[model samples]
Target: MTEPTSANADREVLQMIPKPATAPEIGPWLWAMEETRRGLLRTVRGLEQDALDWRGASGEDNSIGSLLYHIALVELSWLYEDMLLVEPPADIVALLPHPSRAPQGGLQHVESETLAQHLERLEKARADFMRHLTPMTEADWHTFREPPDTDYAVTPAWAVFHLVEHEAGHLFQIREILRRWRAQERAAP
Candidate 1:
């Protein structure tokens, strides 16, 4: 057989192994979260305030800022309310004071905020999440949680996975918003 190409070797070498930034025991989960965060930041780098507040022609009402706020809220909620089963700390509460979902599941008002402010909120919320997530042992990562009066159950691992997935979904939405905003600008006089 011919030797494998470098691209094939690179693909084989690629793995989800954890990095040193996280606690050794819970490294994989934290690494996933960090990777997701990096993807989000990469997608939105240099995004302008007006572009961030743009809603598409469909009147969907989901702007980049609102999605950023929602992403941060979901991660914090999953960690505190779902995994740890405790109240969110004061700093997190201050960063996102409103309920996670709006009255009609539409976007809440995020126009007053700047892109930098929203990014700062996301970073702060993520720092708090890491602080709480780092202490868990391997067994704790697998611990299941079932909130009162609900059949829904999840583990810390699933919660971290959900955070990553949540940000990814919204990252797509942000990119779409940016694309539409550019199209609108091009179409205008």
Candidate 2:
């Protein structure tokens, strides 16, 4: 656990605000992450399969589904493996299912689950993440968490931001897909 360096001094001003004893002062960081999760849920809820599944018609990287799964999987993995690295929390692994084991051909062969099921699991995982992060001591912010068997460089803090970005980008793509889909739907003979 690392202490706040001079680099973060400007950002730590709000850390002075009182937080509930239970939640601690993980404040702006946690709030930002929660809002991001909420935004993702809004995009994902009640989405049609075509809207969710459509790869870019013109051929582009990152289908919406792929992005959503990637975001959710990485966070889930962080909460499970990364958090346990130094002290090794056995109880935590028993808390939730490990993320779909990072797929077969690395990032390409990710798992397939219904949109509803994925959202449900992700929502649960989000709650679990809050439980882990909300009480995180200031020291927890300094250290980096790198998962074993993976080359990714993500701290728990960065993991939250990464999830937000992935979800938001896919949400944008999803909307674009929906726009074109609606046009096609109405244009049909």
Candidate 3:
């Protein structure tokens, strides 16, 4: 049998073991987030610029580009606004140029950005989130942070859980969009 290269060997493993995280308490949550991100990245790999921006003819729905931007922005928002209880520092602010919401209460439309730019933004948000939580104690992980304007409070643990769920949902959406994009292309005269 032929030997597989290191890169191919890495792809051969299809298991769900939780890798070690920054802290023992957060190991599983971080694992979930990391796995979800891997799936998302795989889904969007090699997407052309137009596929990133495509809105599927109706032109009002969220595109893959907007979803990618929103996912990154939500992680940063939770890290700063919810957990740290402050505005995103200047460095984080520079990573996301658009406001979180559009005028019509949807994700802001992100266009013209290459997939590489979107991935970079996501990496920044994920890195910042992991770094900020590395030193978190068990008390902080379970303690709730109540924002003044929000209807409900959230703990670090629950917030990280929600991020995993959120990203998974968006990943499903991205896959469906990709499926439709290909179907449309096939149907074109």
lDDT values for all models = 0.80, 0.60, 0.89
Please give, for residues 61-155, the per-residue lDDT of candidate 1 as tens digits.
68888888888888888888899898876877899876767788765757768878888999998888888777777777888998666689998
Per-residue error (Å), model 2, residue 140: 1.7
**Can you give the lDDT of residue 28 in candidate 3?**
72
- Measured by lDDT, the strongest candidate is 3
Full-model lDDT, candidate 2: 0.60
Which pairs, if any, clash in model 3? Answer: none
Q: What's the best-to-worst order under lDDT?
A: 3, 1, 2
lDDT by residue (tens digit), candidate 2, 69-145: 66666666666677645432454344334344345443332234568766765666667677777777666754687
Q: Candidate 3: misplaced stretches above 4 Å? A: 1-13
The TM-scores of all predictions, comma-separated, are: 0.85, 0.62, 0.89
**Global fold similarity of model 2 (TM-score):** 0.62
- Order by TM-score, highest first: 3, 1, 2
All models, RMSD in angstroms = 4.0, 9.3, 4.4
Who is ahead in TM-score, 1 or 2?
1
| Clash number by candidate, in order | 0, 0, 0
